[model samples]
Target: MPAPPIDARSQNARVLGVELCGDDGALLRIMPLEPVGLLRAGRFFMLRRVDGTGPYIPRPFSVYRQYDDGSIEFLIKVMGPGTRSLAQSSTGTELVCVGPLGNGFPELEAGTPKVMVAGGIGSAPFYLLIQQALAGRHGASLAPEDLTLIYGGRKAGFLYDLEAFMDLGVRVLAATDDGSAGFHGNVLDCLHKQWEVGNLPQTVHLLTCGPEPMMEAVAHEAAAKNLECWVSLETYMGCGVGICNGCSLATRPDGPLGAWPVAKACVDGPVFSTSAIEF
Candidate 1:
């Protein structure tokens, strides 16, 4: 069997800062007292609220960005009770964090042209990813022009962190269904247009994270072109570790015994190849 992404650990992390961003999203920064060497781009942590109680399972959040001082950040949208509590948390609050769990994105070949497609908060992991790419940390020695981002949301305001990518010298194409952004449609439409006009690189690889329907649509497009694609799945979890089996995902066969297999998202992956799993 493949090696687990990273060993799990529980640490008390202090809230460093919280800033409201696009829409109802909050960017939270936390600093762990203990060093978590496993924390990095595309990985995640399960945060147990300090005042958490019954029915409140620990919440899993992707590592939005990791700082040199070992601080980690999360870009969360307040959609429910758990997130609301998190958003209300103030500086100095202690959260029990368990992770750098799950597999990260696979390394791409150096100099390979790449395109990242994200929907709303799905853009979380890519911030650190872009940072790594800029520093040549992921075997990807890409220049600013070699990387492009196609991001989509319901409206322009939903496309948070556009400037973050822009500052990294990445080309960003924004799409909003309401026509309140760069493209007056979904990201798939923008990608299709880029394909039609040969605006995309000839040997491009795709990295995407988003709502299931959107990711599935992007996967289909990649399949049609026989291009390589990687997808990060978003799912609910009872425990941030694999023991709960709360985040199982159906995957394509790795062996001839069967066509489908079940894998734990928390430990096996929050990231997987676009063709390897069923959404």
Candidate 2:
């Protein structure tokens, strides 16, 4: 999904040294990815390669950070043309990024627990959110509340670190589409089993992101429990800002007129509350 390339005029709006509250990127020059904030697990950022001439298409990626030094990272699965280019980038190839955009999960009440459900790359955003929540950002604290993050991937290799999330005082539950990881079922099934066994604690907010199917499934569970849930959406967005209408989606039937759920993936959001979104 190519967004219109940045025009000559667009170049004038460029800012220097984005002043990252958290700066982290890898591949020195090739594939540099970092978090923009004390990223909330359900938070996201607009991503676009800085070196470009065409409509600079922007996409949303989840945050991957677990530290307190304001460093954010992402789990990038190289499966596309854009990313392939970034993966092949040389050292110090700084990318042009826009925003710690979109609405993120708000502070959970002190007594409220948190349950994170992630799918593949979707888990990336939550990684930071979980970190921040546990760190007590925005008057949000997990001190008295329990934290559980359910992570899913295609297989064992796609899976990364449950220990890290656990280290943040989060109880991690892992699953794979295949029976290749901790659970022999999907994340939904894992959540179901927890539900069946009454393992999910009350006063827990659920945050989820990843493949559309997994998110839809998670949505079902959140609805079942009348729980507050947040979601990050991935779309082929062009124009990191809303100027171009590249990555857009159809709003739900209950949406406002002309309410294209397709907000600028760059400007509007890479992250949205499950209820506020049409998805």
Candidate 3:
């Protein structure tokens, strides 16, 4: 039998996959869906905001899967009215999406030491990267212990799937603002103490996602230690596809004083190097 002729809009699909982030949080899948299996793994995605009561704004979510399922996925945390409406959406609803957007991390280099810092729900994007890294094939020869995930949550329950990361052969270090598990303090505090004790590992690069302040702290720490770092920014979006300026951000490290044209977080990047961002 012939396949469906293929929807042109499907090539830039939004309804890629839907899954639960937590109990109340819902994560939507996205993809530049095309002839099945064409989408590459690790590419990014941005999609239109579900039309809610008012205050129109497109939300940005990283495409966690682009593995040719003709769909990709995004992880979301239900924060307010907009996301609540989105969380209630039934699967198979027609959606407007964009990309495979923004540049992602350079695959973990062979034998290169690396750290993944996830704040709250920011761990979404690197879930796949962790899987790949654990396999020792991050586009270069690598190893599982060569990477680690240091994630911070408000408490023990907020730390999702601790065993999943551990089973992948990646040591998952954890911290809670409340000291419920692992360490008691900021994830950065844990990182600094590790660095002080010479446990951070050498030749390490950091890949991170989470709240802006958290990512900023991680970036600053990485920069101070002369470690290479890549940060995924989570800014509010009016249009996840870059059409709206709501998601725009100042590009240069120094804004107004030394900053310049702001780049749209949805387009220019949801991921960027520490040097490229003001935060």
Candidate 4:
């Protein structure tokens, strides 16, 4: 099948609403007046507030949810000037956004056992993927029982959208490093326990996004089981269109005869098969 066309637009999007997640953080629901194609799961946008009260460069955010009303959501953690400004903005604020950029998770085959692993805000993109699967979009239909989500965070309060996913009928397993939640360890431990208990299928596909170290650990586990894994990467992007080449990441070449190639995460991918990446 042909690859989906890139859908990047620079528009003034309104802050329709904001749901506070934890202290000093929020989940923003924004709507672009222009009609946009359904943003695939794992894609992101480069957002800059119109007021320009923050940093000059726009920040990249994974699409948390793309609603039918031409609205999209972003899960933001207050970390810097850009995000702080976004978090404090009230409804009706306008944000200049350029995207629906980057590749998304591949459409899974029918009846494939799947596990989605997320670390903190990394859960942003999976919600749309789950929604698509449940709605049978992209010719991929996933039964509720066939999907499991293993989400980890520093504490129970850090795990966002947990109940929302549960309401969608996907089974959820959680872990917190501080032992303040479901499991007493990291999500890797959760995966291990699930495998040990025969809850994990012999053949499984993994979709994950998180800190690089966490994703790397998941990659190693997937490799050990000979499972196919797709990971969504987070990187600093200067230009969401790949013109500045600032989001380049080292990636294994597509063919066998060359050294690892450099791929622009902004354009080449944010979601890549684990085998195609070196780290």
Best candidate, lDDT-wise? 4
Candidate 2 global TM-score = 0.74
Candidate of highest TM-score: 4
lDDT of model 1, residue 46: 82
lDDT of 2 at 120: 67
All candidates: CA RMSD in angstroms? 2.2, 6.6, 6.1, 2.5
**Ranked by TM-score, top first:** 4, 1, 3, 2
- CA lDDT, every prediction? 0.81, 0.58, 0.65, 0.84
- Could you give me the TM-score of model 3 versus the true structure? 0.79
Deviating ranges (above 4 Å) for candidate 4: 1-6, 254-260
- Predicted candidate 3 versus true structure: per-residue lDDT over 1-279, tens digit per residue: 111112213233445456666445666754443544333223454444444432354455665544545555556677776565555666555444544555556666765577889987787777778766665445765666677788888887676555555666777888999898898997888887777888867558888888888988888877777888888877786655556577666666453223456777655566677777676
Model 3 C-alpha lDDT versus the unseen true structure: 0.65
Worst 10 residues of 3 by lDDT: 1-10
**Candidate scoring better on lDDT of 3 and 4:** 4
Q: List, residue by residue over 61-144, the lDDT tens digit for candidate 2.
A: 555653344444555655565654444454454566555544555666666677778876566666666666666774566652
Clashes of each: 0, 16, 11, 0
Model 2, residue 163: C-alpha shift (Å)? 4.1
Residue 170 error, candidate 1, Å: 0.9
> How far in Å is the alpha carbon of 47 misplaced in model 4?
0.6
